[model samples]
Target: MKTELEKMLAGELYDASDDTLFAMRLKARQLFTAYNQLGFEGTAARHTLLKQLLGQCPDTIDIQGPFYCDYGCHISAGENLFINFNCIILDCAMVTIGSNVAIATGVQILTAHHPVLAAERIKGPELASPVTIGDNVWIGAGAIICPGVTIGDNTTIGAGSVVTRSIPANVVAAGNPCRVIRQL
Candidate 1:
């Protein structure tokens, strides 16, 4: 089952080349432009963007104007979730954001990574790693959550931190390659 899911996700994402990804992103950007530019009020537009970004969303959610995602159908957001302006999610894989999560402006969540090996980087197949942020987590402004990471519940990621790995529950984490600092 794990391998099946992995294979399915790979087919949906990393099987394509950089050029392919760029084209796909370009199309998505056009759609986002049309969607956000739709002259709707706050509540109406928020739902419209959520519906565009995720397959299913809880009612108690609000993402302020101007959000971007590679493909909205691959992402799933939970209840009472709030993402501020300028949020971007590279949801090449399944991105499951939990309930009551608050993401500040300029935050980027990515679920895509390419090969690091010099010989195989170009020839090697792409990799898709899902990201799961637990409930009640507050992601600060300009934070980046990398692929295959799981941030535990009630954790606060400080502003401008780049989370490269999993973080434990109930703590404060911050840094370029983010690590647990201390209990919250």
Candidate 2:
């Protein structure tokens, strides 16, 4: 039998309110609170905390928080990544960001998705998907990357866009559904 965390990582419906999952979330929140409270001068301390919090963090990444995430262990980032303030990554599943990625402020990389049917949603099993951003990708401010979406390398997602689907490489995408505007 898979645990709730295991089921969650597998992208299957799982009980989020399970005791083990709840404890994990609580621990993440505690770390998040401490990390957020640190001043800009405490860069080293912040990095240290982030190292402990995230699944993978290279020495070259900079994230300006108040950052929020479901399970920090499900997030992995490559080197030279810059995540601006107020970034929210709902890593109910894996949220992978590659190297040289620039994520602007208010960007949300979400992997959690609820059931469409109200009856199924209320039954207590929740599902999730992964969100992946390739290397050299620049996600503009206020953009929301939905679950199971993949942004290819060198792609630029416009500000305030809601990306509902995968985007190919070397293009500019924007708007509510985030269509490809042009190729770079």
TM-score of each candidate structure, all chains considered together: 0.84, 0.98
For each candidate, the alpha-carbon lDDT, in order, equals 0.81, 0.94
Question: How many clashing residue pairs are found in candidate 2?
Answer: 0
Maximum-lDDT candidate: 2
Please list all clashing residue pairs in model 1, or write none if there are none: none
Q: After superposition, how far is residue 33 of candidate 1 from its true place, in Å?
A: 2.0
Task: Give the Cα error of residue 88 in candidate 1, in Å.
Answer: 1.1
TM-score of structure candidate 2: 0.98
lDDT measured at residue 147 in model 2 versus the true structure, 0 to 100: 97
- As a whole number from 0 to 100, the lDDT of residue 99 in candidate 2 is 99
User: After superposition, which runs of candidate 1 have C-alpha atoms over 4 Å from their true positions?
Assistant: 1-13, 17-30, 39-42
Residue-level error in angstroms, candidate 2, position 141: 0.8
